[model samples]
Target: MNQGAPNRVVAAQLNIPRGTVGWWRSEDRKVRGEAYEQPTDCPQCTGREFDDVAYAYLLGLYLGDGHIISKRSQHHLSIFCNATQIGLISMAEEAMRKVMPLPTVTRRHKPGCVEVKSYTKHWCCMFPQHGPGKKHERKIALESWQQAIVDAHPWEFVRGLVHSDGCRITNWTIRLVGGERKRYGYPRYFFTNVSSDIRDLYTDTLDKLGVEWTHCTRHGNPYNISVARKASVALMDAHVGPKY
Candidate 1:
């Protein structure tokens, strides 16, 4: 109903909405306020335009034959399907629609051999190309990748690296605080990776916080010895556990 946006068209033959047909755009309330455009290509001909088909087929193959996505295959999928315009689910669905339709044709093969073939032949119609086991393999690999990164200090390291990679943080030797004998024996040392402009601010902050510090070289590095303890294996391990 919004101006300058695509309107819903009721196809007489199909009795269905043809404007961005069979997509979440129809279900979302936000689409009413935004602009819409007519699709240049047919949904059946376009890439992964239909999750109802592509993801469903992949899930079917995964459940029925235990196909898994692989690292190499995932990489390939990412390379080709990275952009939102050409995502894996949409591209895959397009591939499936070209090769296998709702009512697909099948043929039997010799014992122990998969005689998978497609009637709707095209560059994309390569269903059952990756064995059903591939999906399961990919699932396991993803789980392992996730688990390997879980509870790892490298995540914090990576996060800080990313955050301070280009952005300027206060550059100054901030004092480090050592816990009292009654408290946990946490190390104390100076930290000096702060930006030069905010060095005074950082210094004042540490001074007010009652932290101790001493000067050392390597001011730009995060491991500068301006804090409570010297940067060492023992000290690093206390914050981030011993590397396995």
Candidate 2:
């Protein structure tokens, strides 16, 4: 749902058939729009509303695996990755609900198969030495920052290092350098799956944290979105280990 537009619901605005808009309302669905006060009931999370830091903290538990470019089972991998993200988010939500006085965060179900914008940020990474050899250049940098933080704190960190969507988090750390000698602080972040709420949250949180993040622009060699998605699923699957 684009902000400042009369379209209160995204599917309505897009003029997509009601029956085919299912993906828009799926579990762990993230929306993007302009800033507005959160209503009594969350537009995205149904009965569940944003609980400030508690919900934010729950989101911090998610982590991202660096993008991979596997040729085999690419489509299956993407599906699995999206599913895992939703599952991880659900798991975190459940964990938080047990301790907090909040309703369950459920999946969004618009209607049918409408394609909501993917949350994956398309960014490239660059290494100081390689200049070109690095994969997903700047995106890699964001992942690097995340990894660095996770390595140091392991359990208690929430750095908002992510690509374009400005909505990403993980259980691990993404590091940042400090002005002081060898002094660095890990900044943990909570992303609103909803773009409007998240944009508001990002601005408010960043301002509150006194940290600045540069927007990513198109540069360097391009990578396949499908490949990255597959890699992400594989990586997450590997990290989560085996299911009991």
Candidate 3:
């Protein structure tokens, strides 16, 4: 605390109360020159448990618009989306609370997105996909323990993926039958992502769950995957439902 910023900033970053921080850096400690230890546990180091759905959804949020910054002296987790997506912010907050009790949530000033962040050391364990560069350039892999959780709860995992980077859409087309023109619209699900590894993992999970999808694209975009078949869309609907 002494070497860090103000009590407020430290508390916000560390996800603790300012008053508690003051106690940690009390006058007695300051006079005696005692270093205060932050009362927080690391998910990776402590091996704490987490809920499947909440953790998966948080993972989805992380994959879609969230990133973790690890430095030699400091590390933090951040997720940003349009402020209008308040549900996403709330979901991230809920997941943080479930994973640990001391996580602090803060809002930052970004152009149109709402940036909510938490200060925690277990982020790397929670999301091993973190690396030195952007997600597209990184090789994202899941640990055996995490994979076990996903295997037990595949639908929750899909829900997380679709909520963050995928959406339900209606596709339409026109055709001529017997010299008569006809228009038709059909429901489908679309998931867009930049990382091929993530896209493969998503489709693999769907494969394991017996859901069908294809690498369908628009505007020459190769990163698009869709579940367009009526039955498959129904299956996706059953599990993912809606984002909010």
The candidate maximizing lDDT is: 3
Please tell me which predicted candidate would have the highest TM-score against the true structure: 3
Backbone clashes in candidate 3 total 1
TM-scores of the candidates in the order shown: 0.19, 0.23, 0.81
Q: Which stretches of candidate 1 lie over 4 Å from their true place?
A: 1-194, 198-209, 219-225, 228-244
| lDDT against true structure, model 2 | 0.30
Q: Where is model 3 more than 4 Å wrong at Cα? A: 1-34, 72-74, 175-180, 217-221
- lDDT at residue 213 of model 3 (Cα atoms): 87
lDDT of all predictions, in order shown? 0.32, 0.30, 0.78
User: Candidate 2, which segments miss by more than 4 Å at Cα?
Assistant: 1-52, 57-81, 85-87, 99-197, 217-244
lDDT of 1 by residue, 104-124 (tens): 223334444332322232212
lDDT of 3 by residue, 91-200 (tens): 77777677665656677858877777888656886788888888989788778877877788888778777877888877789999999999999988888998988898
Q: Best to worst by TM-score, what's the order?
A: 3, 2, 1
Q: What is the model-wide C-alpha lDDT for candidate 1? A: 0.32
**lDDT (10s digit) by residue, model 2, range 65-125:** 1222233222100111233344443444353443232222234333331111111111111
> To one decimal, what is the Cα RMSD in angstroms of model 2 from the true structure?
18.7
Q: State the lDDT at 31 in candidate 1.
A: 53
